[model samples]
Target: MQQKGGAAPSLFRNGFLQTILLSNVLLQIGIWVRNFAILLYVSETTAKDPYAISLISVAEFAPIFVFSFIGGTFADRWRPKRTMVWCDLLSAVSVFAVLLTIHFGSWHFVYLVTFISAILSQFSQPSGMRLFKRHVPEEQLQQGMALFQSMMAIFMVLGPMLGTFVYSTFGLETSIAVMGVVFLLSALVLVRLPKDEQEPRTEEGKGQFRREFVEGFRYVWHSPVLRMLGAAFILAGLAVGVAQALGLFVVTERLGKTEEFLQYMLMVNGAAMLIGGGIVAVFAKRVAPQILLAIGMVVGAVCTILVGYSTSVPVTLVVQFVNGLVFPCIHIGISTMILQWSHASIVGRVNGVLNPMFVGMMVVSMSLAGPLKDAFSLVSIYVGSGLLFLFGALMMIPIMGHKAPEKAQAAAPAPAAVRTEP
Candidate 1:
């Protein structure tokens, strides 16, 4: 796993090169804006709780649990570029439809739009990732992954500010319209992806999509390594959601800040994500995925413990930054390992299983976060999450280990082990 440590390798050139970068940027912009619009519209227009926001966290991501297997199969069978293009086009059209509904003063459309976006997003993401694997070379996979993570980091870091500005300067509808345009732009960029060998077109490809979805899940059920990886991700997502759901509460109560401090807390943590992105790009492959996963869980655990005790914004920021750097390494490693273990044809199915496995856990985690916070304490949440991460790290010890004759374990190096999904 060791390689040159200081810089990422060269991996892209030409118009096709610009295409990947630009498309990633556009996709992030569209995602951020669309999510922002939903949150804002909920806070302002909805009167169910007077200041009611639909408690749709569960509904939002839980669909991936249901749809990932189908989407994954499709991603594997179809021409990836065309698949991604259609997904983006669907996104653009869907966003535009929401905008029209809003313009016509129909708040009722929000629920339908939200569900549509959720389902369509699963199709777009796995197909888009398939393009990354097809175009990027094996030797440069680490750098490619790092750069991809960084691209997401930039969008994540900048998205909220830009979305807010658009909404404020123009209007909410203007922001929604901008998201549609970005989706269209992303689709165009995807159109340039170099064609690769098509997947096997068998009767299996035409089988019941639902059955295909179950088949992917069955793959995970059968593989011990994949099962452990899934458990690690499930708990990891839940751990983060617990903390994320309570971030504002942490600062205001512990640091004695008012509600206004929420913005600063969010901004600073977002900035830390940029730091995490850089670390992942520089070290994703240089460090063994297993080793990184171990360190990530350990560091993240320590940060969480520190965060639980921190009494001020500065202390919280430092702990938060530490958590940020490690979390991405863990995430990128899991994703890279999955891609490495998969044949290109089955990559989509693998990703589809992961989409729900990861996202769906967050839904369960968020649902319980409120009850947990009320019953125990925020510090308990942090400590519990940290403990779960430690458990997750320990779980990885067997996964990355090679399955060979017992005699080989003595002769071969004891590879660094961590919880892995691939």
Candidate 2:
């Protein structure tokens, strides 16, 4: 399926691509439902303390911060499908365990379950990325990635509403148990994929798993493109994280909100993401890779700033629409470029390295936003987030000089001294 001369694969024939798109839809749907409800569950079940609620969010991501780099490296080393299946199975098991613990135990057990789920899920990202490249032709990467992201957006738009309904009627334990089943469903679909779709990378160590895992970190650190992207990932994530954390407060306080109207705005933003993703899938192949990276960051950053600048909810909604529009391009484009840029062996390590960069940004923003909201205006937080986006744009500069592997080799100049004079 690999295309020469930098051509990407056409999307129609990629079975793995189709399988992932379908599986991710279900996986994300379950995730969206769980994500929205988990915090509320933590607060209600755990005596309603705000700090404990904060921990709910932090606990889910805390392990990702610690394990992401290793996850990425391991992703490269292992068969993506195998790794992915195991992750999903473990996630399902963890959730089921929580249900059992909750039957016998305290509400705090729910929080612990959420944390374990987060750790299991981190491995799936790198695994999926590696798997995609195997069955996908290089030319269709943009469309393929777009299709993947669009599914997540589709689920996000619906997941919260569904979660609310399910939780209200079914109660928390039943809803969570269902979410656990969703992971098993994903695992079932994943099992259908070919085992060999995992791209082979040079294994660094002949000895123990720990040593091999550590080598994954070293491999990623050595690659300049990955190193730079790691930094950019952190910065871009911070801006987005701040905006996400402050969303409800900003909507209710500064801009008066009708509940129905807020829902409409969310719909608009989610639709924009789907639309943007589709557009990127079709048109991105013709664009320069570097330009795609820069444009996505620049537009995403600008939309963020505008979302805060105006007081009108409608205007803010428009900005969010624009933000959604710009976001997929950045996500899909950067992902496409980064995956293309790295070699197979180190894919896991590269992703693992990326873990800290993004997790650091998000952890800082979510933890600090509440205190900062107390100290400074939410508008200032928004504005500060915008400035962070500008920093993300600056990070895109290093994306410019990347040449395809063959092209780089082809472009190397022959020595003049080696040729005899005529």
Q: Cα lDDT of all candidates, in order? A: 0.69, 0.71
Per-residue lDDT of 122 in model 1: 73
Q: What is candidate 2's TM-score against the reference?
A: 0.87
Mark the regions of model 2 whose C-alpha exceeds 4 Å error after superposition: 1-9, 46-48, 197-204, 208-222, 258-264, 406-422
Write model 2 residue lDDT over 1-422, tens digit each, in one string: 35555545457666777788777877776776677677667656667788887777777778887778667756655667888889889989998998898888876677766788788777788888766655666666667777877876776588778887877787778878887999999889887787664222233343245765666555456656556667677887788778877777767776777544666767889988888877877887787555676677777777776766667877888888888887787778667765666554455555676667777888787777788889987767777887777777677677576664532112222112111122
Please give, for residues 97-175, the per-residue lDDT of candidate 1 as tens digits: 8878878977656655556667777776787666665565554566666667667666666888877777768767777
Residue 39 Cα positional deviation in candidate 2, in Å, after optimal superposition: 3.2
- Per-prediction count of colliding residue pairs? 3, 17
lDDT of the structure predicted as candidate 2 = 0.71
